[model samples]
Target chain A: MDLDMVKYLAELGKLEFSDEELVKTANEMTDIIDLMDTVKEIDITYDALKDNHNAYLNDLREDVPAPSMETAKVLQNAVNTNNCFVVPKVVEQSLSKGVVIKWTYLQ
Target chain B: MDVSSMTIRDMRTALDERKISATELEGEYIANIKKYDDKLQSYITVTEELAMKQAEQAQKLIDDGKAMPLTGIPMAIKDNICTEGVKTTCASKMLENFVPVYNATVMEKLESQNIIMLGKTSMDEFAMGGSTQTSAFAKTKNPYDLNCVPGGSSGGSAAAVAGGLAPAALGSDTGGSIRQPSAFCGVTGIKPTYSRVSRYGLVAFASSLDQIGPIAKNSYDCAMILNAICGYDPHDGTSAKVNVPDFTEKLGQSVKGVKIALPKEFFGEGIDSEIKSAVLKAADEYKAMGAEIIECEMPSLKYAVPAYYLLACAEAASNLSRYDGIKYGHRTANAGSYEELIIKSRSEGFGDEVKRRILLGNYALSSGYYDAYYRKALALRQLIREEYAAIFEKCDVILTPTTPTVAYTPEMTSDPVQMYQADICTVTVNIAGLPAVSTTCGYNANGMPIGMSVIGKKFDEATVLQVSDAFEQGFTPVMPKL
Candidate 1:
């Protein structure tokens, strides 16, 4: 993996690192990916997929809503909240266009 | 009685005979923690106030003649398992101040029995790494030797039990987390069959592979705790509906004619000679006790480590995505945009190992690499599972060393690959979603504990516990010189 690819993947994962750390991370990831090359030798058969699918499918429960944590307690761990989680400004006025909104709060 | 040294059975006898009150038992453990925990760094949050309250309530229950086996027993919980109103940090700065409003299903079950919880123990950040060194908090040192690490991400739970700070503790295992630490700390730990234990309130690391199990001084104690915590729950979608058996009932049964397999593939080149000899010697002990030992081969398991890393990291990437700045956990103070805020929060909150796994996972799942890595790994995992099934058809259980080597000084695992290799001997059990227990066999020349694992079929914790308990009957654990 290239340094730039590491940066792109980091951005996709919503993580940040210094440029030096990214370079180091890229190298480490390259080593890990290389190690994973061992799996390529195995024949591709869907036996596990079949077993996994069957095991997980039949275990579903009825979708009834059960009692949940109280709203005050749920919000207790929130860093920025006023009966709801608070996030940074996601909407800004575009210089060449009408006011743009990036997100809207759920009611 | 020294409550810290007493097993759950011993403590129960004391409590029954009025030799010790529940409050007195809790106080003894707290005193032990105060005397020894700073040197070991095993706990993240010690809940003395809550423990005392619970102990008082437990005394009322005992006096009322309503005590369960687990009632009034003080135990530590891995920081990853949620506790209502108490901090569950997962040893990460991300959840450094986060507290849950509800208990995990297991925690609720333990509470119903009036078990006294001493504290939240340390672990790898978000249960990501093999060693506790990756914890954003303190690294838990091995009780046997302070310079060496208690293997992790369940190191704190293992260290606490082995150090006699807590009689028993709870830990979640994903790729040998609980077993490895227990082996290193000279305690017994069980990683039950996948879906055997509910994962509802466990902070998810690898959703498919994680199972919560008990770390205790012996397999019987492990079975006792398993009885209290094991059962199906509607809260965890993956929990199996299979009837929960009385695990302790299988104890003391004859091992005569039991077919035990020694997979030659597991005892390969990388394994330390001492561990191999000790584990083989343990197999011989089983043979002397009338169990038939046979050698078997499972070649596909060679790919387990790589396949496990690929699958675990892939799941981790998806599961850990929930930890953005908006909800619970740490949030960044300043950011120009919403994306920037999330990125900055994650970067600042997660430890280096957690970030590395996320990066690897994202790379594996990236557009061009998905089939080459993730899909291939899944197929390999299936092949490995099938191999286990084929082997189990002729064998009641498989025996192997819990880890290739005994506890190493924490610094020896600085390189990622070196740390990953430590899990090679143990990851196959999790990959196959099988039940296995790591119990003390003997110590190496350095005096660090060596553990042998007895693996049984899916949800067949009875056989696994029986074999482990049988071994414990003839074996003496090497207690760390505290």
Candidate 2:
């Protein structure tokens, strides 16, 4: 896996990893990839794979418009619901903090 | 009479016959809870007033001949399940005060059936750990030996039934939460086929594998609870559309021609020698009763722990994002910015194990390595599921030890990896999205309980229960008291 791709993905997830953390995550990623590569060697019967690997699609009914909660009704439950859920905009820095801690543990 | 000793099916029968009132049953469980809960730490909060109130209301409906299947039977609900207008803490400090505005879909189903709610049982924080030791408040101890863990993250639900707090309880299974705890505490629990029970209102933890199930004294009681909760829900798109059976009615069928498979992966090196003997003894009993026992070969099953941890925690990292200081939970009074508030609230709110998991999940799904780790893990997960699907064609149900070992004392908390391996025999069922049940088979040399796992075809809970009920009724060894 490429570091650029890792950085880009981490950024997309809004998790900021320190340079040191990035180096470590990259190595760990390589290790896991190696394991997956090893496991990937097992030969799966094509018939079994085709039979069991189909994606499930939900059976949907025709859409009918239904009244949802009124703005005020929804706001009543929020600590600060604006017309929708009210909140202070999340700062980019804080967003990364949650993600950063996660990567730290992975490393 | 000790309400805890009577099975829910029998209790429901008596309540329905007017031989005993719903109110009378509620009082008995409450009395036992008061007597035993402190020693076991099985509950975070007891709702005696609320429960008695519901019991009285159920009795009025019964008087009008309006009782449902679970009407008047008291139940201990794992705290993680949302109960509208009441706290659903998930045993985490983050949402210690946040009560949902609506009941979880399972709770709604139970309310419709008029079941008496005893209280919220204790659990690992956010249903994250093997032992209830990771809960924000306090750990739930095993009923048989107070020094050992009751197994977790649904430990309290297991302990409650075992210690006679309540006859049955609702528990969530995400990577063996229900089965392991039930086994540790010497009770029976079933993790229904994924999406067989609705996940709406269950605070998500790997939405793909989470299931709502029951822990009971016996398989019959487990079937009784399943009758009330299993069915489709529009709220959970993945919920099965198959017809829910008359569970109690279908039980006691012969097991002569049914094929049961024992996964080769389940009997390997990680298994304790003593626990291994108990499990083989269960298989032998099934053999004597004329069922064919064969080995299930699934080479990919060993990856279950890593795969489950990755998928579950990754979802958990995102799901728990809502519990910031700005939400209705523990908020930091001091912070440098909106961001600092989140980090501080989270850092302070989550215990070490919880933090460890969130971090691991975050790491597994981190951008650059998503396909290499999380997604790849998912593909392997599918492989494991395929393995089960293939084997199910040859067998009616699969059987294995629920956990690789018996109860672990609190000392194992220091070694996370060793403690985690305890769920080795169980998590694959969750990973494969299959319905499975765990019933006590025997006890180890020291008398710690051992459990047997019975995995069934998707949405085919009936076969699993039929075989389990046969063993639970007469053939299997009763778990010796710890």
Candidate 3:
């Protein structure tokens, strides 16, 4: 793993690290990934995947609508306004096109 | 009464015979916690008021002659498990003040039985690390030696039980969390077969691998707790619909003719010679008791650690994604956009170990690396399970060391991979979704505990408990001197 990859993963994981910490994280992740690489030594054969279906498929409960926590209770832990979670702007108008775009940054 | 040495059975007898009131028992435990917790730092939240209230209710039940087996029994809970009004922090800043609106299914069952909750215990942040040192709260010390750490992510539960702060405690195991800590803390703990216990409101770390079980001073206590907590619930979709048995039913049963398999891989390189010999001695003890000991091979054992890390981290990455600033948990005060808010909040909330896992999990599941890492881990997981199934075909149970070595100081290993290697002995049981119990079989030169594991077939906790209880009968567990 390299700094670029670490940065990408951090971005994907919705986390941030300072430049120094990113390098340290990259080194640590490299060691961990090396450990993960040992799984490649497993000689995968067709027999392994033969019965790879969900073993608990029959155990799943019926997907019926059921009573859940009240809206007020559900939102009680959040920063809410009128029972809805309040959040920073997820969309912003593009200055050039005057069209809304998803907000994003690399941190 | 010596609350420090009393098991649930002893407490039950005393509570029922009027030798000690439930309130008195609760007060004794609280006093012990107050006396020793400053040095041990095992608990994150001590629910004294809640315990007193539950003790009062338990006394009323006993007075009315309706006391259940676990009634009036005080126990500690891992912080990961939801307790309706108490903060279930998972020992992370992320959920530091997050209180659940409802209780976990296990909590509900215990509550109905009138069990007293002494408090929430600390653990590795998000149950991500093997050492309790990763907890954002206090680092729980090994009761045997304060310089050493109590093995974790369930370290607090195990420490509390071993320290006599609580008789027994509930712990969740994902890749040796419960058993490792129990072993390190010189107590007994079980990680039941996957889905044998409900996982509803467990604050999912690895959805497929996580299972909640008990840690206690002995196997009988663990069995009693398991009896109350193990059962199907509509709330947890993965909970097995199989019949729940009296886990303590097989206690004192003969181990004669029982086939115990010792996989050669577990005793090989990286294991401490003392731990290996102690576990082998345990097997010999079983042999003397008329049980058949058979040496076996599990080639897939070499891949278990890697595969477990890949699978568990991937699941953790997905599960922990819910901690964004929007819905609940910590939110950053200075973010200009939603994305920035999530990144900042998570960056600020999680500890180093948790962040490392998230990053690694994403790396494993990333678009180009999925097949090489995540998918291969899944295949290896299947292979590992099949290997266990094959061994079980000829064996009643598998015996192995719970950890490669005894508990060590926090400064023992700075390399993360070295720490991961310590779990090599216990992770395979979780990978196979089997029930295994860790009991102290011997002690090291420094008086640190060495644990041996007895793993049973899926949902066969009765036999597992039977074997563990049989071992405990001949062995004496040394308590840490407070």
Candidate 4:
């Protein structure tokens, strides 16, 4: 892994790191990826892969609505108004087209 | 009453005979925590008032002759497990102030049996690291040697139990989190098979690998805790439908004619000579008791660490995506837009190790690399499971060192890959989703504890505990002076 790859990963992961941290993270990620590459030594083919271990398909409960945590209790832990969590505005109106458009500041 | 060395059974007898009141017993433990916790740094939050209130109720239950085995027993809980109205931080700044609205299924069961929870213990942040130094709050010291670490991410729970802050504590193991710490602290711990215990309330680190288990002074005490906590829960989809057996049923049973396998890979390079010899010595002890010892080869063991890290980190990336700074946890104060808010909040809130895993997970799941990393890890996991299955066809249990070496000072693990390599001995048990118990087998030349694991087949915790208890009967555990 290189600095550019680390930066791309950080972007995908929604994280930010300083220049120094980025360099350190690149080196560490390279080492860890090297370690993970040992899995290539396994002799199994991709076509032979099957999900037969540790799967508990039969234990899943019925898909039905049941009693749930009250909205007031669930919202109590966050910044909320009217029992709904609050977040920064992420949409805007395009005045010429009179249509909602993605916020340019998102990236 | 000299409660420092008392097990859960011994405490139960004392409470039943009216030799000590539950309130007084709780007070003694609280006092001990106050005296020793300043240096040990084991507890993140001490629920003294909650413990006393529970103790009073337990006293009433005992007075009414309705006491159960765990009644009035004070124990510490890992901070990762949710307790209603208590801060359930996974030792990270992200959830430092987060409290649960409801109890974990295990906590509800323990409450029904009238056990008092002393406090929440520290852990490695998001259960990511082998050493507890990654925790944002406190650094837990090993009770045996104050300068060394107590293995983590269940470090505080192990230190609390070893340092007498509480008799026993509940810890979650994703990959050796419970047993490794217990080994380093000279205590006993068991990692039940996947789905053996409910995972509804555990702060998700790795969904497929996580299981909650008990760490205590002995295997019998661990079995008692397991009896209360192990059962099917509708809330956890992965919980097994298998019947929960009395784990203590086979404690005194003979190991005659039982075949125990020693995987040759586990004793190969990277393991300390002292740890290997101590584990071999325990195998000899089991042999003397009429059990058969067989040597075996598990070639897939070489690939376990890589597979475990790739799979665990990938799942962790998915599970932790819920913390987008909208619902709960630390939120950045100076963000002008939603995208910036999430980026700044996550970057500021999470520690270094957590960030590394998250990045690694994302990289593994990315388009081009997914086939080479994540998919291959899944295939390797299946192979590892089949290897264990073939071995179990002939052997009843497998014995190996719990960790490669004894606990070391934080300076010894400055390189991250070197630290991950130390988990070679214990990670395969989680990879195979089997049950294993770790107990102190011997001490090193410096008097530090060395632990050996007895691994059994899936859903066979009864046999695992039976073999562990048989070994514990012959070994006398040494504790550090407070």
Residue B137, candidate 1: Cα error in Å is 1.3
Better of 2 and 4 by DockQ: 4
- Per residue, candidate 3 scores C-alpha lDDT tens digits across B1-482 of 78889999999999999999999999999999999999999999999999999999999999999999999999999999999999999999999889899999999999999999999999999998888998988799999999999999999999999999999999999999999999999999999999999999899999999999999999999999999998888888788888999988899999999999999999999999999999999999999999999999999888889989999999999999998876789888988776888899899989899998998889889999898888888788788888998999999999999999999999975789988878899898988899999999999998999999999999899999999899999998788996
- TM-scores of the candidates in the order shown: 0.97, 0.87, 0.96, 0.96
Candidate 1: where is the Cα deviation over 4 Å? A47-49, A56-58, A65-68, A94-107
Fraction of reference contacts reproduced per prediction?
Answer: 0.76, 0.09, 0.76, 0.76
Runs with alpha carbons beyond 4 Å of true place in candidate 3: A45-54, A63-66, A80-82, A93-107
Give per-residue CA lDDT, model 3, range A1-107, as digits (tens).
88999989999999989999999998998888888888887678425445555465237777898787787777767753444666665656545543323222200
lDDT of 4 by residue, A7-100 (tens): 9999988999999999999999999999999988776744343664445733778889888778767776784344466676656543453332
Clash count of each predicted structure:
0, 6, 0, 0
Candidate 3 scores a chain A TM-score of 0.68
lDDT tens per residue, model 4, B1-482: 78989998899999999999899989999999999999999999999999999999999999999999999999999999999999998999999899999899999999999999999999999888877888889889999999999999999999999999999999999899999999999999999999889998999999889999999999999999999999889999889888999999999899999999999999999899999999999999999999999999999888899999999999988888888777888898988778998998899889999999999899889999998999888888888888998999999999999999999999986788898889998888888888999999999999999999999999999999999999999888888886
The complex in candidate 1 yields a DockQ of: 0.67
C-alpha lDDT of candidate 3 relative to the true structure: 0.90
lDDT of 1 by residue, B1-482 (tens): 66667899888888877889989999999999999999999999999999999999999999999999888999999999999999999999999999998899999999999999999999989998777988888799999999998999999999999999999999999999989999999999999999999998999999889999999999889999999999989888889888998889999998989999999988999999999999999999999999999999989877888899989999999999999977789988987767888888999999888998998888889999899889888787778888999999899999999998899887797788778767888888888899999999999998999999999998899999999888899987768878
Q: What is the DockQ ranking, best to worst?
A: 1, 4, 3, 2
